[model samples]
Target: MSTFEFKKNIHLIKILNLKATNINELIEGLKKIPLNSVYYHTHRFLKQHQSISPEPPNDFAYWIEKALNMKKLSEIVASVNIVEFNKLWELKNKYIEVIKKNTIPYERKKKCNKNEEFVFMGCKTFIIPTGDTASNLPEFYEKLKIIESSSIYFHIFESRLRIDSQINDFQLWLNENSYSAVAEEIGKIDPYNMTVENLRRKILNIIEKHL
Candidate 1:
């Protein structure tokens, strides 16, 4: 990722900021920023760092992170609506479906137009999408701009849903742990003498942590 270049051209900047103008002016303004700066800023703004998961033996998390990072990278490349980059958009849509399906023992294998597999992932495989390496970077970047500024809000909603899903998973784990502990305590009690007040407190504590 590159650094964000601060522009000295106030008029160009104003034009870029104007919603009434065509995006060409904004693209021109963005070009003034160094390539490295633009790359770095785009990555940072898109929250690329949070994409990675530290968990081992579940490299899907890591792969998903990288795929999302690549999406961000692609957005930077196309600088227009990502849908304008048909291949990238299609790949991204498929990847999202794969994630949402959460299927077991599934794999994603990428085949070229000639039917040659360029990237393949098994049940535990981690594969990053790669294609169109020879495409113009500036054009890609333009498509990314459109994606970043898209008004449809699907991406934003998807991100929020992912967060909610994580929270739910954590809650389920806590419940499982709490139930195990409660079972242990019940085993020590006399017939019909078990109390749930202690378990309730533990459950409350878990809920509080999430809140």
Candidate 2:
């Protein structure tokens, strides 16, 4: 497999270790990663691994299990008890059983190639890369990416980056995830033809419709 197969962190350099006493703590603990880091990873992931359309992703639990090299933890997560329980702490308890000592920490890597994108399991925050044309105009893009309250914000960010990258990431992600119909409804925007503000408006508009 290529090095690209694994998602790497590049935007933010702060490495955080998480140990949760409660669901609230867990939520806050995960938030330390910062918006820039979160955006970086989400964009990079979408760019590097595009499928045809979007769907629910099996997020952090599985990634952490793999990154930490915890086979047992992964096996438990794969089981369907998650279907029966509906509480955050209920789910947290299962994970805590494995990492009570907090030994499995992954470093937030610094300085990935501009050609390379960030990946997350993941973190909170939206990050614009130095190379993103929109990022050049922080006055506009910052307001767009900072995003006060919206799950679709990330979706917008991912779509924006996918369109901006001018690469095959989104296509692969869509195909891999089996989200074919959604792509047909969406028109492509060439990053080359777009100005920073135009790009921002384009993605924000696209995400808004979905939200």
Candidate 3:
């Protein structure tokens, strides 16, 4: 049988030339920005706050609330379920749809200060092997407890975007190995709602039980 070679990623943040001071410009930028930029904004919190998961607000929603002071609109945008969409474009469209639908006639005219403009940022990911391979469920569970939280985040969240698949790397691997029940339980996890450390614990518990 083939072994699962664990991998980890490091993301370098790049500030794009795009910035938006008003709702109209923000929508335009959203429509045209690269999918990597979209992934960065939506998943930035998850990547940065591996130990602390908050109410789950993307950069767009945060700027709308803090900079523009659109409390209601920001709330609606923040509520975009990051886990629901597998494709980056689908997530981007949902954000544009929500923001466009919520903005009033005069809301488009609202603008923040020059310094408060929403600056678009994207990340360049470098995936490297961790040299940890698991030949079976027991080995997988043992390695899971010792790997970095970022590795957990990569396999669970970033892998979805990388493969454009609904299932994460762990789930996919498990299912491929005929561990369908374990994969299903892992799929039940909501990656956005908990810290990466907590997510690690949850996955360990599921695999440990099956072992």
Ranking by lDDT: 3, 2, 1
Model 3 root mean square deviation, Cα atoms: 1.5
Residue range 133-166, candidate 2, lDDT tens digits: 2211222234455433222233334434434432
- Residue-by-residue lDDT tens digits, candidate 1, 19-102: 111122223333343322222222222222223532221222232234433243233333322222223224344333433344
What TM-score against the true fold does each predicted structure earn?
A: 0.16, 0.24, 0.95
Better of 1 and 2 by TM-score: 2
Best by TM-score: 3
- Find the candidate with the highest lDDT and give its number: 3
- Give lDDT: candidate 1, residue 46: 29
| Backbone clash count for every predicted candidate, in the order shown | 22, 18, 0
Off by over 4 Å in 1: 1-21, 45-211
Off by over 4 Å in 2: 1-28, 50-62, 67-184, 187-211
